[model samples]
Target: MYPFVRMFYQAWKNRNAPKLGLFESHHSRHVCMPWDIDLWLELNNGRTLTIFDLGRVPMSIRNGTAKVAKDGGYSMAVAGASVRYRRRVTTFQTVDMVTTPIGFDDKFLYIEQSMWDQTGECCNHILLRGAVIKKRKLVPPKELFDLMDPTLESPELPAWVQNWIAADDTRPWPPTR
Candidate 1:
């Protein structure tokens, strides 16, 4: 089951956070419960992604993207993502998550996120390509950014992200079995 209760708690907890600029970072903390673990007694990979959502959504709220989308009747979705898991997060251990907008292109907006364990070691990192939706069609990121702030100009996407984007484009859709 999706953690609806935790989602609500995060929203309520960060409601008064300062508004963030388009490229600024949003930080939050979370703990790994027994339910978040896998057979190895460490944070499950899938749940780690969900935890990243806990960071990103509240981030969108603090950065004003969520409000702009709501007011404009648009919604957001992750078009693609790549994650790297490097360390274990045992039960009851807390981690700090940092999420930031890296940049955007004509098609999608890119965001980078990472989770740091109590020891300050980065346990995992992910880069996501997100799309804004309206009428079941994708909305260009610039349009949404314009709604948030006309003065917003996307910073140049990092080379690593650019490479990943280009590489993803080469993969056949409906990938062959």
Candidate 2:
């Protein structure tokens, strides 16, 4: 149910777009309605991660990191993800999403989304792992890239997202089943 009016009309229609730098790529565009299908009708692996939060909140407001997490009080979450789908999107189809920012280490911030289709293919792909909270603690994506710019930097995290962050650091947290 969280479409929040298409994520507030895609954060006020990309709030003037343009910015994006920490590995820029915020393409947007979507569709597949009919309640985003399921029951074998297509597109619905958990509503494709809740429609990828309408393309990662307009790619975090066109990469200004949602205004440096709303002026540093901070609050970005998605602590982990890793989707893949390959095809099918039925109802009104459309797609074109994109979203980037594939770097950061001192505690999360690593994104990558896709979802092409309309002939270009790539029906799905995700790899998020964000974080930055502040008062509730956990806030170190290089301090949200030193509050959004500080000469940017963060570019190395790739070798397959550092082997999926070293295989999610050997998993095993409380799941002995």
Candidate 3:
């Protein structure tokens, strides 16, 4: 598998150095969870967005133009995602997952995705926090933030966003997009 945030995080924990791109024994899997794809797809086409698009952001940060960008309103930035699994999921089976944007201050945008199988049982839940950066700064660039305004109103946000924000009590950040 290729080197990614999670794999590198684990490598840092294990005292294993990273090899550029991918390594045999260092990384195992790099599959994008469904929810992330949905947002990116929606951001592009707004009509035909799907789970496939949600999983493509890591590779699309640059040299990938959004399908629906008008001029320079949107651009890719730094971000990271983490997922927990209870059972193995095969690509053959389609799953139902609801996603929503929970919050976005200045640097971080939090999104939650919940997956349920055909039987209506929760299979996996994931939270993705993306930082919108430009030229290595923590502030959200004005142009990109304008594009994200339409996205913030998406119904995908789960019902528990407020609670999550309350629980998320991190370091005080008074700035925002």
Candidate 4:
């Protein structure tokens, strides 16, 4: 009877672990852990992962930029993503960042994000290629294109850049709700 009661008590206490962070162990400070924000936290930072997240797809689906839509707005489902790490980043290492919307075509949207260390060193980067589907088809409807093209078919990017995130022939986006 004593053993059963102790086991139940331990389980009950373990259920409410706010006193502990996700990876924090007993007596851990739980202060340096990172948050997986915007789904970009492929690293340990307490901030949201914006650019590598849906920033590219949303930018492509809405327009050549990550600019918010003017009408009722739009949502994008990421067809796929790929990231190539150039270097390692330790905890709390701050870096300068930049993002550029190269362009989009047919059923694919392409974007690139760069990260630079405090010393202006190129720390790492991610190349993203995604797709937009309105009804589970590769053919983007008039409304999607209408929303995308307001001024130019594609935006201009800086020189000295080349790595691109292109789409695979397979795996289309889920239909927009």
Please report the TM-score between candidate 3 and the true structure: 0.43
lDDT of the candidates, in the order given: 0.92, 0.84, 0.42, 0.41
TM-score attained by model 2: 0.31
Clashes of 4: 0
The positional error of residue 64 in candidate 3, measured at the CA in angstroms, is: 16
For model 3, residues 1-177, the per-residue Cα lDDT tens digits are 232554344334434333221001111222334432333332112211223133333222221223223255344543645555544344444455454445455556665555556777765666666565445555453335455354332233355654555565663666475
Q: Where does candidate 3 stray beyond 4 Å?
A: 1-70, 141-143, 147-177
Candidate 4 residue-wise lDDT, 46-105, digit = tens: 232342342233223322322333242443555545555565454555555554545555
Q: Give the TM-score of each candidate.
A: 0.97, 0.31, 0.43, 0.49
Q: What is the lDDT of residue 83 in candidate 3?
A: 56
The sequence of per-residue lDDT tens digits that candidate 1 reaches over residues 1-177 is 788889999999999999888789999999998999999999999999899999999999998899999999889999999999999999999999999999999889999999998888999999999998988999898888898778878888989998999899899999899
Give model 4's TM-score versus the native structure.
Answer: 0.49
RMSD of each: 0.8, 13.9, 14.9, 15.0
Ten residues in sequence with the least summed lDDT for candidate 1: 144-153
The order of the candidates by lDDT, greatest first, is: 1, 2, 3, 4
Question: Which of the numbered candidates is closest to the native, going by highest lDDT?
Answer: 1
C-alpha positional error of residue 124 in candidate 1 after TM-score superposition, expressed in Å: 0.2
Give the per-residue lDDT digits (tens) of candidate 2, residues 71-121: 878888899898889899988888888888878878888889988988898
Once fitted onto the true fold, the runs of candidate 2 whose alpha carbons sit more than 4 angstroms away are: 1-13, 17-54, 57-59, 62-65, 75-78, 85-95, 98-114, 120-122, 125-130, 139-171, 174-177
